[model samples]
Target: MSIFEEEILMLIQCTPRAGAQWPDFDTISEKDSHALAAAFQRASPFPHLVMDHLFPSPMLQAMAKEFDTAAPSDWREYHSGLQRKRGTPPGGHLPPTVQDYFNVVYSGPFVRLLSRITGIDDLIPDPALYGGGMHEVDAGGSFEIHMDFATHPRTRLVNRLALITYFNETWTSEDGGALELWELEPPRCAATVVPHFGRTVIMEQSARAAHGHPQPIREGRQRRSTVAYFYTNGLAARDANDTLATTYVPHAGYSRRQKAELYLRRFAPPMIVKGLKAINKAARTRHTRGRGSKL
Candidate 1:
């Protein structure tokens, strides 16, 4: 990348001290970085920060185009009746431009940037992008509010942070695809982030961080976002059992049908549930043009 390009990356706000750590590519400014760190350290709820224009404009536009044109078969289908989406791993088929962006995030400069922003050290990027990578939620799909799985399935690292870059340029509140952060002590939504184009949401993952986009996507629109989880080796496991499965929770005002679906998904056999989802997906497609909804 050119020096001009590197400078633009650091436009987020970084302090002189952070300069010692990353020396290149503007991370958030020093004042803003400290504020973000303070927020993450607060005792209230799981700390998070929403940043706009996270990456350079050209880079984001390129990534968006890559996702928009990619074939449905390139993505792995994830259907859970209530949540119908697709995720593509960063592997052989990824385009060069998309790979360029991923390469920067996986690089040490960006890792240090995250460490500085969250005040968390020794952060490691998941190479496999397990549960990360390109994610898409189709119209009528919804992911229930719940705590993410604390443990990394393959690396055994404790999941510390979740970085999501929303790419739906024309998305709006009427679109119904917002990442809602919930507070469990009293059961309420603490914040709701619309999947705005070029917007980035950095969420600190903990037992207290309950979130999801339970509202169905509006007709004729899809929620597109890139997800990446950061991990650390120092944090202790959440419990003695060391469970790695996601803990799904129901929010207030949820309908009976929604509650039932959540219960069935939690307890049903994997194969049976998957089979049911496949049948449902097929039926839904047969009636209406699925519009790249094959997951």
Candidate 2:
């Protein structure tokens, strides 16, 4: 590994449980390094964001060109999702394409470090678990605070974690779209980041991980990154005692009127929810069948 790569690897090899410790990547010994990986895997601790100069900068910048996001087809005058704003991807699709980068990241040494850190290597998230691979995100686009898609379509597995890598140059505090991680207690805004390069935020998939940005980008700024999601074996196959479910929690920053509307969407009757979903599926099927029946 290059010196840069080794340095970044050491930074990520430690536990976030110690808060964010920056290791002197050059001086660590072999035994100590082994312990770092061992400690990470044995504890099953919460994933922490890792920052290092090692996150291939030139590579990510070049990769950005491939993200060909389409116009917001789901755009609405009044947004009713995580935030009361818009200009975001409606599903797990990045504009141009980020499939290639994801393939390298997951199987690379990065995964090995993460496997040790999370101590759940057996259940590590694979690119195959994320439908269409990892979704890509960039500037002027923002996601409302919500749990991820919940499940990977093809794998039928409960998504467990999210790994985000921000690749931007000298991200300033003023950058409008800094990623915001809100506090679940008292429901307040907590951690917010400018999405700088070489910085990776890996967090548990839960209500506590409630995060999103709430502002529009400046004329020249861009938030570029690759996101990878992990999943457990299968929600049904997991040990009964190991059951874990992700809950959706909206940002407290929204007004009461907005929240009441959200509560209704979240806790409405199962039948109502099922009916709505069924209607959507029927509409999609009709659209597809209608298009083919023209033959």
Candidate 3:
């Protein structure tokens, strides 16, 4: 068997066998796969799909609980004008519940399923978790519209697709955290997706595929999701300076507040920025704690 197949089997072994059957290759029929392919093939704005009920009900519930209880230390805090979020990637270890979920995501069967949907073959999961993982954005956080980095930092593989699964069971339109897809030549939002529970978004990443949740979330709530990026060794290498990081596109009538924040982030010393973020996070935490338990 190939290395990919062997790794897949190992991931399967990680699944809990509590008398419940998880979705797998054998469970997905050819007809459904073909239909998914055709839908994505002719999708508008860009090739993408919003698949509901992707995981078992029990598993989805477990995922939401896991996100709620995930240790703060596990999250790598990102604080800046462009984005303020928390994320954690697989680093040789993870909670059993999370491990089980990602095991299936990175498995060969799922990889093949994604290939069928996107019509992009030879896709491989990025073990390093570059720009992919469990992401959480609390009240007032947002990611600016930007195109993803084209190539992997370590492997230089061309990044192809992004798969994100939302776990916000109570997200609403008023929350203002929808994933906004944009058009570039004349920037405008083409589509918006409310981060609903158990909804999976498969986006075909390209040099022009700009996206983000530009609006700050409402107070007293958080948006949660998991993301995994797929890659292929298809594109030739370019100069290091050309494609090593995400390129942000500012919207028209960008606020002076945002512009000032961006300037400080761009030119400030790293240590100062880090200290400021810590202070900001502490303030936010205190504010949330003062509100008492909403659950």
Candidate 1: residue 100 lDDT (0-100): 70
- Which stretch of 10 consecutive residues in model 3 shows the poorest summed lDDT? 1-10
Residue-level lDDT of model 3, residues 1-295, one tens digit each, is 1101000001122233356556755456677777777777665556777777777668878877887677767778777767888889446345567667777889888898898778888898986677787789999999988888888878878888999989887788789788887777777777777888888888988866788998898999899888889988767422223375776766774578768766665678868867887888898778778876653
Q: Model 1: per-residue lDDT, tens digit, 13-105? A: 432234242224454567766765665566345677776755767778888899877876679876663456788854435656766766767
Model 2, position 238: C-alpha lDDT score: 29
Q: Mind sharing the TM-score for model 2?
A: 0.61
Global lDDT scores for all candidate models:
0.73, 0.51, 0.75
Tens digit of per-residue lDDT, candidate 2, span 106-215: 65445555555555555555644332233333345445555445555555666666777766678776777766666555565555656666676665564345666666
Residue 132 deviation, candidate 3, in Å?
Answer: 1.4
* Model 3 bad stretches (over 4 Å): 1-20, 89-93, 236-242, 260-295
The 10-residue segment of model 1 with minimum total lDDT is 1-10
Cα deviation of 12, candidate 1, in Å:
4.5
